[model samples]
Target chain A: MTAEEWEDFRKGHPKAASLKTVPLPFPELCATLFDGNAATGNPSQCLKLQHSAVIRIQTSRTLEEPKEDNMAKFSIATVFIASISLLLTLTHSFSLENPTDRRILVLVDDLALKSSHSIFFSSLQARGFELDFKLSDDPKIALQRYGQHLYDGLILFSPSTERFGGSLDVAAILDFVDSGKDLIVAADANASDLIRNIAAECGIDFDEDPSAVVIDHGSYAVSETEGDHTLIAADDFIQSDVLLGSTKIEAPVLFKGIGHSLNPANSLVLKVLSGSPSAYSANPKSKLSSPPSLSGSSISLVSVVQARNNARIVFSGSLDLFSNKFFKSTVQKAGSSHKFAKSGNQQFATEISKWVFHERGHLKAVNVRHHRVGETDEPAIYRINDDLEYLVEIYEWSGSNWEPYVANDVQVQFYMMSPYVLKTMSNNKKGLYLASFKVPDVYGVFQFKVEYQRLGYTSLSLAKQIPVRPFRHNEYERFIPTAFPYYGASFSTMAGFLIFSFVYLYSK
Target chain B: MGRSPTTKDDAQALFQSLRSAYAATPTNLKIIDLYVVFAVSTAVIQVVYMAIVGSFPFNSFLSGVLSCVGTAVLAVCLRIQVNKENKEFKDLPPERAFADFVLCNLVLHLVIMNFLG
Candidate 1:
């Protein structure tokens, strides 16, 4: 048929036109054809099959038409592609409202390290993370393609690589973090300058002596070789349930790498693991040089930083901490008879990975609402001495899902120039936190602020401004009985004037 | 500090002269003076009551004291206009003064009633 004739035919038969546009499943199409043919009573089964056959034939014929039909077909194809791209863009946007990152990119120096660290990698995979392992020097590797990040997190295990390929540099890695992505960096003894620079950017300074390794002669793990006291056993972990799992780690962790010190000015960086008081960083092969630069509790074995944007990062001085060998190795600290069959590396690695991947400590607060007591609708402004209740729903991302975050320290402040009402909120065990307090007996522009910062959770800072007004003139109580004497005196004065007036004018 | 009969005689003479002068005043003026004295004493009594009972109802205290003070003032104005010896208000009539006093008292009572609460 000609194009005009086909258009007219489609308009005349509305049912056929709709069927052509919306491709239905076979069974549903059969049902629809059967229903349509039921009224005619003309052998419905045969008619249903015949209708579907006719539609297939018409669609095929339309596709094989001349170039004159290309305009309409091209527009339809373009619309379909556009809608799919829009849907993908919507899913790719990073937002704290949904604190789950699905994809990760792991960079390693050698392919053999992948097998050595398979325990750590498998743990991440079992948690629903799509890990893409690539060599650090791969020329085609790129963090973003066409202004879209391919992964939500980056793991740097290539401590020896001097430089990265493609557009990946220290700045590019920092840019990824600035866009609210997580990072986990592992460096070893004699780490390359590039890795040291990245650690420096995160407010950590590695020991300047390249040969220096963290040596704890007093707390060194008892090994069979009895070599230089370079292998230290670290038991001083940060006392935080969120960073480390709730189950206490009984065995000390094994460390055989360089040590770092945190920058005093950077408050965001926290020393998650520290060396023993007898531990010091000095050249293991050479004699004792000038005093060690990093010693005692100042040497941080592992540190974590939660950036202002909530992009978490973990820096470990030893890449072997994540290795399966270290995880399975037995550890017995010097002068201690308690021998652990398995080191604490596995649990420590898993918990720190969970934290860095935005799975443990990420918090999201939503539906912040406040209204007067016994009222449902929020008011634009409040009056002084008003009894109000504030509510907020907070959830923590537990690797795979949002779970209720329960804590007793969440507080809300009714603040103008200063806090007028500071009350600790009560929770309903279902993620809803509520506080009921009377608005202070002062009127001004005030804000309902909740600044909740826990030990390891992401800070929840919320402030909503509202105005408070004084009572209107007509709203005041009138003619109180306590002032009846004053009222009587005033009225009697008026009466006295009237009586005195009459007497003075009439008495003659 | 010597005990002298001259000092006692001087004080007695002063009281006698003051009584003689006050007795010469007109009866109507004297009646107005007595009314002023009554209002002033009532105001003093209210002040002492506030000092003892505390000014918890400050607006009531203010209205009570102001009413008595206002009455004393109006009565004094009436006394001045009807004295027949005060030359400043000789042209002004006592009835006119009483009318003004009644109007002022009415306005004062109206405000006090509103503020009493």
Candidate 2:
């Protein structure tokens, strides 16, 4: 009936005292408390009392008397409760549940940057990221507290701070990166040695001359005053649509920063924006001293590293590259007359920020499964030369909702000491990647390895250990037709032996 | 290279002389010779068969050929021991030699059966 009548009926019952005092011991009874109709709010108070009255009788009869009528009702109630929770979990599973970066700690050299770079900061905020801005020398600053990382990503815009304030240091930041946390580092003309060391650890070498800035005489942006040619209109960007969004950046970006060179030994690091062929890194104020160490297109203005653990980091030579001034500026290259209303700085910064924060180009492989061709369940060990199929669901986090990652380049390796079978997997365009191959004839412990490292996407390295065994004694074929002659020959020799012995012994 | 007909004549003369000399061979020795030839021919047949077919069942091939060759070798040893002309094994009793031959044949056949797979 109504909640008031249900409550009154429960209180009027003779066993109402025990029902009120006794706790709901079984989980089945506990579920009634949640049936407060989650769709509508707080009527569950009276609704719980009403539902519990029915559940109480069901439990009492089943525990003591075992009546069929109440047992049936109790069973139906259990099904209802299970469906409710199943629906809850099903909806949760469909939500964006991947490793998209959420919390970030932004360390700034000065408080003025918070206002100067508010446009870029607001964009990050609008994208549902929680940014924690603090001065570099804040004594209480910490990347971690009590062995728990405070943020999923770190932004170091404090290039001039010689040393980080509290527990944040070179080793702590590197450890954060090693733990698969993302980072963003921006350095400028006055970049301290501490900032250089941090960049060096990430396989980059900034210009040794502290005062040097990238000077491109050929493509310097035309300003109101003819300033030094350090402010270049650089249009050289990496040709990855995934790294830089699919929309081509037409206008050259205004860049005023020092340049760095990526170490050749580090394959993980790549230059996102490089200087035009005529650009060089040298002190704009001083006369030409021994040809500039970093010159031409080799000078990297912006670089990104995807570490082995898939921790992405963006290293820009200019902090102003992320400032509102550059994002709002109109630009014209010196020689050419084509001027744009806005620079490409904002688009570049936003897309790179998305990359660094794992919004775009993040890949995850799930449900790695392998079984025999005819079977559905995975076996503990495989016999040598068994034809089997391997399947994995690979979905790229499309900077958005989880959609199917359709690519033909993914490969699976049946690896022992070396790869025995390396096959490119076929996909269904709906995220299911599969390959069928025969187990190697040789038997040993082997691994199903997927090492996917593409240019812009986060690499997916997965290995599942599987053991291969040679055939058991009875598993071998009992009678082969080709060996029949051998069997015949052997038997004939035995018969000959018998006859020869008989003739030899009975000769006398 | 041009002496084909003359070589055939020479081979026929060699065969004639050998048959004349072997005619005086003891009857029991002739029986042993027949048994040895049987085993040797069986082994040769198996080798030819293996050449035609691939050696896929290698263990079976080895066991088959070895059993026949081994029986022929043992039969020859028995013949030498029992022969009156073979002075090398003269002191070896024919009974002991025959017993040795039977035992060796049993062991060889056992091994062949085990490897026949």
Candidate 3:
């Protein structure tokens, strides 16, 4: 009997089995002991015991005996399950290439959003993220459970949901980002205070007017009949391929929503797209009363913020920015004859999604080393005026792999209170940067700093503390040419005293 | 005319007494004074030489003049101790003072030799 047959027999009985002997042909006895007569009392217990012994014997020899097909099948099944579990663990570990974010908790107004924004949802899904979608009113919506973070990213697409029904609120949302989670917020014309509060935490202010929509008179998309020019066709996007997409946006993006202003105090927030000079935020159906609070080019159509904690947030006024309709719409400026078959919304949304998800703008610095030009080991301390070389390699993550980050302005500042020596590092195309400089004459605690912040690239701020010491007395040169006159005078006086004393004494 | 003759006679008498007192000075003391004059003159000559040719080797010039001055000073002490008319150094022997002066002169020259050039 095989181990499986014995286990089946053991489960069939209620009491524990004992180790005993059975008499029959090896296969017959093994099969009979497990599935023998349903004997009651001591006899059944004895039979159960015999079955357990036989099962143990069979399993002990299962690996050695290839003839047992059942045992082989059971072992194969265990191996398959173990391997599958190991593969799952490895997949989860490699999911978040950048530690800034990994798992995302996507809260929506309903489960229907999972399919409505399938294009955006699937893009994140393909990137090895575990997205848990819950209705905004679900009592179980939690950013953390038992002090451990439940998610690393959040998407606020439920613009109209009054209040998150669980422990989640405006404060909780801010805490999630403060702990370093990437966020993408798409606000409509009537976005709730919950969303506006969240946007404020990210240093952006949406128009306070509840009914105002982004209205552009000059750049409205030309439709069949002349209608309200509330629908804008904007293409004056930021000219950064890294921030937007590598491909130029040919078609104008159709936007129908409110406008926002980035906080003047927050330097990290940037306006990616601006409204035209004629555009203003006001009630489209009502008569003009007071001056609109947000108007003209001051209205930022799209804004992005990189928090001090390195958390990324993207705020766009229109929730339809990611909708299939805007992605597929054709656009023709009101006064222009050119008509593009598609809008820039799809490409803009996709590329911006990739950036918010950390598929780009990820930087890693490694192999920081400094030594004498040809030496391998770093010295404990640098000598003043010594010629030394410093090398640091930098690479940027491009969704799949690390590629060399090439730039001419990457500099190394040998700093104390101020930069004593600032040198631009030279790099090979492969990302290996090298810089050589003589240590400054001043000696004290100094730092080698690389403060690299460029548009569209994640800022790389690296500072390594090092001590530079003055040369030891013995280390100084024994003879100096400029000071020879001083030395000569010191010795010549001694010689003159000897000659004058001899002459004076002899004359006396 | 009588007043003019009397004034001339008084001046001549004073000169006569001064000459008689100078003739009483000891030969060794006169020799020491001559040596001091010679040392002073040599220092002055060196100073004039420095003024004409610049103090390029100023330390050498200092030690040269100082050595001459030290020798003359030691010689004057010896002359003062040996003088028969002097009472302050009556207990000090002329031979002992001379030996002391020679030893001090040797030490001074050794220091001067080390200091000069």
Native contacts present in candidate 1, fraction: 0.48
Off by over 4 Å in 3: A1-101, A481-485, A495-508, B1-117
Check candidate 1 and list the clashing pairs: none
Residues A6-27, model 2: lDDT tens digits: 5686777645535444554543
Provide TM-scores for the models.
0.79, 0.80, 0.68
- TM-score of the candidate numbered 2? 0.80
Clash number for every model?
0, 1, 13
Q: What share of the true interface contacts does each candidate keep?
A: 0.48, 0.85, 0.00
Top-scoring candidate (TM-score) = 2
TM-score of chain A of each: 0.82, 0.79, 0.79
DockQ of candidate 3 (2 decimals): 0.04
Worst 10 residues of 2 chain A by lDDT: A35-44
* Residue B48, candidate 1: C-alpha displacement in angstroms: 3.9
- The digit string of per-residue lDDT tens for model 3 on A1-508 reads 5566556766774332333243522545545665445243345555555556666776888766776787889999999999999878656543434443567878887688777778777777777777788888989888888886678788888888889988999888888878777888888887998888888877899998889898888899999988889889988788887889788888888888889998998899998888989889999899889999998888999998877666788899988888777877888998899899988888888888777777787777888989977788998899899899999999988877788988889999999999999999999989999899999999999999998887767788889999999977467553344323334433333354345445434543
Which numbered prediction scores highest in DockQ against the true structure?
A: 2
Ranking by DockQ: 2, 1, 3
| Candidate 3 - chain A - TM | 0.79
